[model samples]
Target: MHYRRFGKTNLWLSVFSLGTMRCLAGESNAEENIQHAIANGINHLETARSYGKSEPYLGNILKKLPLPREQLTITTKLPPTPDSQVMDQWIDESLERLQLDYLDCLAIHGINTWEHLTWVESPRGCMQAIQDALAEGRIRHLGFSTHAPLEVILAAIQTNLFEFINLHYYYVFQRHAPAVALANQKDMGVFIISPADKGGRLYTPPAKLVELCYPFSPLELNYRFLLSDRRITTLSVGPANPQELDAPLAVADQDGSLTPQEIEVFSRLETQAETALGTDRCSQCYQCLPCPEMINIPEVLRLRNLAVAYDMTDYGTYRYGMFENAGHWFAGVKGNRCTSCGDCLPRCPEQLDIPGLLADTHQRLNGSPRRRLWG
Candidate 1:
């Protein structure tokens, strides 16, 4: 396994960290799965208080495993609270559940809005309790995970209060690229959340994506894309069983550079997208903003682009259905909510039919409702 310095935290973390959201779900082989991952060099285990049964499951598994405590890094997350006392209780609860004396990392989970940010940065809010924990050696590092808009993410990074950041910056959804760049500037560790699953659901990729990726599977291609940017520290891989770790482990030694084949695949993807969408293609620039209906026009349209260009209808539908269901984590109304007020029309340099395209997006990608993993 290849390890990278996780920004200012100064810890060498494996490029693929084990995300335990899907662990202990039903008839799970938790011990074998975790042990296999650890044996193959995935030294970081990430869980959350909200990932039902995950913390306690890890606690039991850790006790039974023969590994030393210091050999692995364990991290957990809790949402921000209004009161520092409540935050204190949460910390104690997570520790007790995990049966750990202290945590290698504690991330303020789901800072997905301005309000969530306020909850963390307030004078008597979670940060105070986190600081106390840090001073008392309960938490070795402080970080935050967010699904907020780019502005909110940039604001959080600008605070300089965090040693690391966990956010979404996938090969398909590069909207958070600026946030990643800023995190690198601040020397903050950048951990990508759910690249294979949330990042276009590459685990079950479409035919076009599979074809574009050529020799590499869509999952492997995405991993290579993220790891090529040295600023990214690690990616969360949620494997259900021992063998599920093999795909990511195969690409572990891929250094911080893209192969010539990778570059060709990237070019192929872009050219195909442009060719498929023609002049109506969304360039992903954020000029069209301040929608009257609070619709995330760019993201909504980008989903359409993916579906239209790459035949990624299933992936598009899965993500689109999570709009209202995900609350602040996704942070936008669906494309069906566009009122055709023409507010975003003039702002769009592409001069695209904003309302018509949104209608088409809603038409093409509408499906059963979906929710985020933590939602």
Candidate 2:
């Protein structure tokens, strides 16, 4: 594994940092995975209080081991709720859950809008709570994670309040590239979350994406693509299993940059993919599982992305066909049946706008004259 300094913090962090989302589900031996990662020299372990028992699970594992707290960097997040009292309680809860006296880094989870940032900066706001935590020695540093548009990220950075910022980035979703560069210029630590979705999805892309990525794993190519830019300080992996961890670590260990041929391949693949898929971010992970509407979420999104990326409707008819009875499936609570209740939004490992995306897809696939549905 390779390590790099995390911007102005002057702390060395593993290029491949372990994200705690998958670890929370209790699918694997939490203790073993934590020990194995630390044993393998992964010094950075990121978790969130909202990650469904992740903090508590990690807390249990750590309490059993003799690992030095100083040697490990534990990062967690404060929920983006407007309730200051709730935020404070959650912070204390997170500390207790992680069995730590203080967090190395505590970020404001999911700063999705500029208004949210403004609210955070206001009096008695979340940022103030973070400052209070820092004063009380409960948190060492402050940061935030975002899935908003690049402009929102830029706006947040310009506020000059964050020590670091986590955002989606990879070879395929280069929209955030300029923002990453700007963050580096500002000397802020840049953490790239889920390169597999941001990068890997494009690497092993669908048939159309494969034609775009050419000779790379769409995965390796995406990693190489991100590594080509030195501004990225750490790349967080949501490894469902140990095998998922190995691929990126292997790539990080390699010295030197992408070969000219690889670079050319990336360019060609990117263009081909854009020509084929339209949007650059969807990874088709199929995690929006058991679609309530039988709408084939991943497939429909894939076709939509292709239509937008490639500017061709070659797959539209087939995509619409899949959604033929989507309403029936959704009616009983299956696919595009989101009620805007905001439950699944936070549960999503990808942090996607589940409701909004579903609504848009429903309209596009079932709203036209040829496919109109009576409400």
For all candidates in order, the CA lDDT equals 0.90, 0.69
**lDDT winner:** 1
Q: Write the per-residue lDDT of candidate 2 for residues 347-371, one digit (tens) a residue.
A: 5666777666666655554433222
Alpha-carbon lDDT of model 2: 0.69
Per-model TM-score versus the true fold: 0.98, 0.73
The positional error of residue 92 in candidate 2, measured at the CA in angstroms, is 0.9
For 16-59, candidate 1 gives per-residue lDDT tens digits of 99999888655247777788899899999999999988999899
* Candidate 1 Cα lDDT to native: 0.90
How far residue 160's Cα lies from its native spot in candidate 1, in Å, is: 1.2
lDDT of 1 at 72: 88
- Stretches off by above 4 angstroms in model 1 are 26-28
